[model samples]
Target chain A: MNTITHYSDEIINAFVDGELAAAERRELLAAAAESDRLRQRICEAVQLKELVRGAYPARSPEGLVKGRSGRRGARMRHAAAAAVAVLAVSVALLLPRPEPGQRLADGALSPVLPLSTGEEAGETTRVVFHVSSADPAAARELLDQVELVLREYAAGNRPLKVEVIANNEGLRLLQQGRSPVAERIRRLDQRYQNLLFAACGNTLERLRRETGEQIRILPQAVIVQSGVSFVARRQQEGWAYIKV
Target chain B: MKTMRPYTPFLLLLSLLLAAPLAFAGSDDGPKHKIVIQVSSDDARTQKIALNNAVNLQKALGQDNVAIEIVAYGPGLSLLTSKSRQGKRVESLAMQDITFSACGNTMKKVARKTGKEPQLLEGVRVVQAGVLRIMELQEQGYAYVRP
Candidate 1:
């Protein structure tokens, strides 16, 4: 028996799954080349997994008609196998649905307040508002609604740590200190200690060419990359998402 | 007094067990703790390892403690396809709550050349590019390792 070189869990699992990339597979193959025993160990682990799965019966007797006569058991097995096949096929046909990721900084779409508000002012909660629009007026209106809601929530003692994430068209809201709704936003920010700003980097690199640099973001605004992704990150961390 | 005595030790042990994981889990200081997985190669072997590492990370540290993202661009994007070679791995990791982001730029470029949309593996989400997505994820506090 040959001594096995140390292996990380990552490498070992990859080895078991037979998923090492060519270079990695080659590296492992070369490393294990000296040890037939190590190779066998990896193979045994993979084999053991299959055996363990096979160890369990795929169907439970409960699902089958209990009092069925002898012939039905065989037919039930066949039906179950056929059902699994159909299920596999349907799963294969299913396309990926975009459920937004947590900590959404990319402006990915996520749930806002449920149509019906659930909890009442339990405590001050951090909330992120995703704003994206090509039209300046609409973006301003979205901000207005957010301000109104934040103030309403605040009156109930639920202070909001509000971050306005403007990406793509929403970048207009943070134009170089000249957003059409700047004063209104700043007023709320000052009153509430809220952060109102553009994602400076995402805005400059992506939105700059589209809207030009002259667009004013309020002086208080700090820029970050991918406002949508930033918000996504926060949402993932359990901050409820609102797109107003 | 009799009722309280029976419950006290049980509650104490439960609290200790519950607190232990959070102590280990919440410490951000351990390990340069970043993983960046590349799914660019269409090879099933490589794709599988990339996903396995993702699962292991989530297992070792709760998913919230560690950030994971899979970037698939170019030929790697095919790994995300339901019919593609590595579809099963894509599906498995998705069930474990790992995020699979596909490359939009690759789709656009490939779709233009192939005259058809590049199919994304059933469970993968579309992002701008595998590399770009990695960069984005890294910026968002994920450690990067190209497995």
Candidate 2:
């Protein structure tokens, strides 16, 4: 059961779609041979592929040849056909349509206001601190460091935009009551006008689904749809990214 | 069908013109080789081996010809921390264009127990999930190496 649970639907789909490399294919096949549950999963995946193909029959290619020409023309046609085949396969396997309610709007995961935008502004040095560890002490230390850096900038009369983005195990630090540094975080939030904390919604949802625990985050933390996308967006906006 | 006969030669020429570039495009740059190295242990020796692997790979395949990314997660992330003994070494390799990514998940976990976030070395990017990053690189045809 443990082994079966480890095989995600994505992996199974990749295997069924022939996207796995030879080594991975061999490994998965070996595993499937040993576990009835895994074998069932593989069987289900194959059936789903057949069902999809059946539903989208037009997606399957038809013969393109009409009449024979010269050797060079034949070679060119073959190359073109092969290219088309590759394109079709990639489009089919790589581009999975998003399910309803699964798609997020652009910047939906970002804080309502950019962390760098505040009253005292000359030139804003935007920085995003990423936290993914579950250790409460480490989370507090990270916040401490963030404050140290911010205070240094403040001494120089510089405006700073700071965001602490937490995902996965790091989300624990944002949990209310459970977080060891909750008091420190609240105090820091009150003191820093330009600092923000974001918790990953994806992780929260996963925790709820897996453990049936309704985790409540600190009042200071904003929920972002996905932490990675938020970080990527910040990076693209030219913010300095730091992992703490 | 008889009327379409005259258009066959033109269609063949058009297909050849289109396909020729597509075929030659692949040869112009040759194959791009990529590798993702995973570091999930805190052992200094293991960290050294990962670094050695990167250095050796870069030497074997000219740096510009190969893309290499080292992903550190869990306790192995110590290798990229500013306080780590190997911090200087990590920075040196990063200068050679070897990407170093630290897992944010691990950082938070460590922060929870320690009440502090481990300061990462300069130029090391923090990703939401280290394993996911490796999976992405692998999906993009990068070879996975766990040295």
All models, RMSD in angstroms: 28.7, 16.9
Q: What is the interface RMSD of each candidate, in Å?
A: 13.8, 11.0
Model 1 per-residue lDDT tens digits across residues A177-196: 54677677667655654444
Write candidate 1's Cα lDDT for B1-147 as tens digits.
446787789999999999999887877564335555667566777777877788888789887666566777656777787567767767877776677888786688777997988776656788744543553454445654555
Give the TM-score of each candidate: 0.32, 0.40
What is the C-alpha local distance difference test score of each model?
A: 0.55, 0.68
What 10-residue stretch in candidate 2 chain A is worst by lDDT?
Answer: A64-73
Each candidate: fraction of true contacts kept? 0.00, 0.00
TM-score of chain B of 1: 0.69
A222 Cα displacement, candidate 1 (Å): 1.4
Q: lDDT of model 2 at residue A216?
A: 82
